[model samples]
Target chain A: MSAELKKALYNISALADLGQAITSESVFHEKIQSVFYVITGTFLANRGAILSYDKSADRLITVTQKGFPPADLDRVDPEKLMSLGKNEPFLIGDSPVLAIAGVKILAPLWVRDEFIGVLLLSGKLTGSPYTQEDLELLNVIAHQIAIALNNHSLFMDLSDKLEENRRLYEEMRHIYHGTLQAFAAAIDAKDAYTQNHSYRVAKYSTAIARELGWNEHDIEGMYVAGYLHDVGKLAISNDLLNKVTPFTPEERAEIRKHSTTSHNITSKIKFPWQNVQDMVWHHHERLDGCGYPEALAQESLSDGVRILSLADSFDAMTSQRPYRKKMDVQTAITELKKCLESQFDNKIMLVFCKVLEKEIKGELPEPDILPYLDRDSDLSVISSMLEAIIQELSAP
Target chain B: MKTVQFSVTSRLVGDAAVIYPKGYLNNLSGESLVKECGIYIGKGITKIVVNFSETDLINSIGISLLLQIIEDLKNIKGTICCTNMSKFLQDTFEMLGLIQYMVVFPVESDALQYLKVGKV
Candidate 1:
């Protein structure tokens, strides 16, 4: 190859390398400085500087420099600088200033149809005239620099969009969680003695699910269901819910209607929680065909509902109530063992037993007692609770 | 960004109140149309004739507001019959599942004919 062609090929390869750097995740200022250094150091021995427009101030400002005092330009006012709009390129030594004695080339930076800035190359300190080849190369470099700047701007825009989407998803998730909590509270409020039952059920269900090697997503779904399983109880009469004596068969059937009620209630809300609705509907269902509502058999029910059913039964048996003195934790385990296939999913029952054993050993916090031992339906309390929760969520 | 404009006028037909509406149906016009329908509902005008002779555009917001009107009027056994609709608007109404609740007529007289027969 001819020497001139080889030199041209080398310059092309160097330019491509610079383009790659600008495209990479390198820091913004470093890329700008590298472009300034490469263009001025390789193309000429003259002092060089780059100026970009300050859109807010409507003036050109120096960005990067080579062989020039980088800080001195800062003290100069923008309006006093030579106008470099469009195709206008002003020479440095147009005045008789000593600093610009033999200055020569001035290349304006442009990309697309808009003029972004200019490239100012002054006289060579060793007394040299900038050749046509040098000017050509400098012009090409300035064009590439403009392209790089635009690319960086786009990257910044995409970065901002990603940040905005992340913030939106986070805020939506928070609102969803708060809504679920309020629904759980409403259910608890319906039955005075069952106030904190949902919270404990959620804790136990989440523990058993984690021990069973479920993924974090499934465990989270189970957590929501455990807290909201009795949501349908909102439709039941408060007197029926807190009855001091055992229910008649007809009253028992009326009580069982809450499962379907809860299902219908949850299905109306838009949430990524289909399993929560199923668990609420089927938590009373037995492995055998004796469960109320649809009486879904073991084979038809989801694994989540099966696990929740076991947790719900265990918690009810151990909890102290008007009808039955609290069963010993050991007795509850034995009862769970006796009715595994008949009333509960056997695998889930076994996990429940293990979780109970761990609890008895004090491996975790003692199960919380139910609240709302006293009843109050004053409008002020409910309104204040809702307002406090909403304020916490909307805080800056 | 499209503009939809319409007017609601009432005609006396036997013992029923017939309402006539015209204009494009988009975001800008859908709100006013819905509000006017509510006023008609207050006046005990349960039967309606919506004339679309001058309308050419309907967006999702317009369709949603029309659905709201249908739901609101359903409890009173009130009916809205759409007439003088262009072929394009008829197709759009069908695509949005609005035809199931509101009857469609090829011309104003056809809708009035149905009202005479109590078939609306």
Candidate 2:
């Protein structure tokens, strides 16, 4: 092969290597600085700088530089530079895109036939006009530089879009959280006696989870499960919910459907944690396959489900109800242990016992005086009154 | 203790409906609030001044419902202003970006002035 052909092959190989490294470099300043060194060294030039075109803004931005005056860099116009012939370097005296000193060669860079930037190289170290072969090598190098700049631009744009998406996701999450809190409050308002039941359940569930060494997300999932656990009861009658007497067989059947009902209501809301739905649905289920709705056994249950069950029971025992006396801390603790391995998960019960061990031993705060309704006299009378009111509202 | 029931009373003044809500504004109250606003919406009296002078103890549920009311009013190119908000409610509204889209007044007179002018 001819000497010219061999030199050109080596130059192309060197340019190919530079192309690979520049595409992967993350920081723009470092990337352009490295490419500027390569350009200056390849042409044996004294000074150089890259002027990258911002096509959208119709402006030029400084990519990198070596020995160029700041004023000259500011004065450079990328549009005018891009209009130059791809191969030809303009002499300082003859060039139209000048007022800068020491910059003797200007070459426009392109990739896939699209102009991307300009390489401004100063007078040669030997102080002579660049040879035809020097320009040839520079042309190949310029193409590689263009490819790198294009890749960098695309990478920057993608990063900006990703940041924008993250912000939007956070905004939507805030909205959903506020909405869910309102709905949870609505569930608590199902009856005057059950007020704040969801909030208390959520707190107790997370406390047990913390005692059991569950991760933050699992603990939070338990809280969400507790908050949304009783939403299904919305479809049941307020009279039934607030009735002080033990429900009859038919009434018990109506109440049993609430677990599944809650699951259905919360499923539409789409909680961040999927397992929360299972926890809500299976909270009433027992260990020996006697639980309602799903009748899920020990093996079918997640640890979170057990934690929720424990929290639900703990709050129910402590809460003041007009008909049934509230259980003391000692009685409640003993009751949980007595039914362990049958009605509740033993391990989760242990965790709850340990976490509340301090609070149980301390002063017992008086429970609130909840609005009381009896099924025998008050509820039936209230039911009729409520029915009358409903009829009145519905009437034209 | 059980929460008190929520109630809203509305009166017409010029072209606006001035609403006064009583009791704690939680989940139960939030529902009544929407229905109260709905009555005005139905009547085509879109200019509204919701006064909180008689109420306090609003929760997240109440705030969510209030956001809905504001959005409904905006859809009709109508203006709604809130009056007599405590410092806490004002801070909550500003933090949630609610103030960006609506004006909050320190008194009923200020709200009425804004509603009369229909812009802030």
Residue-wise C-alpha lDDT for candidate 1, range A1-396, written one tens digit per residue: 554564465456446545654665657776676565445434433356777756567666777664456555444344433345433344545543214323366666667766566666665433446556555666667677767766665677799999999999889878877887888888888777776678778877887787678998888889888888888888888888888999999899898898898889878866565577888888988889789699887788888888888778777876766667766554665677677678877667555545544443456565322121122333344334434433443356
RMSD (Å) of each candidate, 1 decimal: 31.1, 28.8
Error at A315, model 1, angstroms: 2.2
Looking at model 2, the pairs that clash are: A232-A262, A285-A291, A286-A291
TM-score of chain B of 2: 0.88
Mark the regions of model 2 whose C-alpha exceeds 4 Å error after superposition: A1-28, A85-93, A112-115, A207-220, A269-272, A328-330, A353-396, B1-120
TM-score of each model, paired residue for residue: 0.59, 0.62
Worst 10 contiguous positions by lDDT, candidate 1 chain A: A368-377
Per-residue lDDT of model 2, residues A30-132, tens digit only? 5665566556544546568887778888766778776788777877776677667764455565756776788887777776666777788887654557777
TM-score of model 1 vs. true structure: 0.59
DockQ measured for candidate 2: 0.00
What docking grade does candidate 1 earn?
Answer: incorrect
What's the distance in Å from true for residue B105, model 1? 99
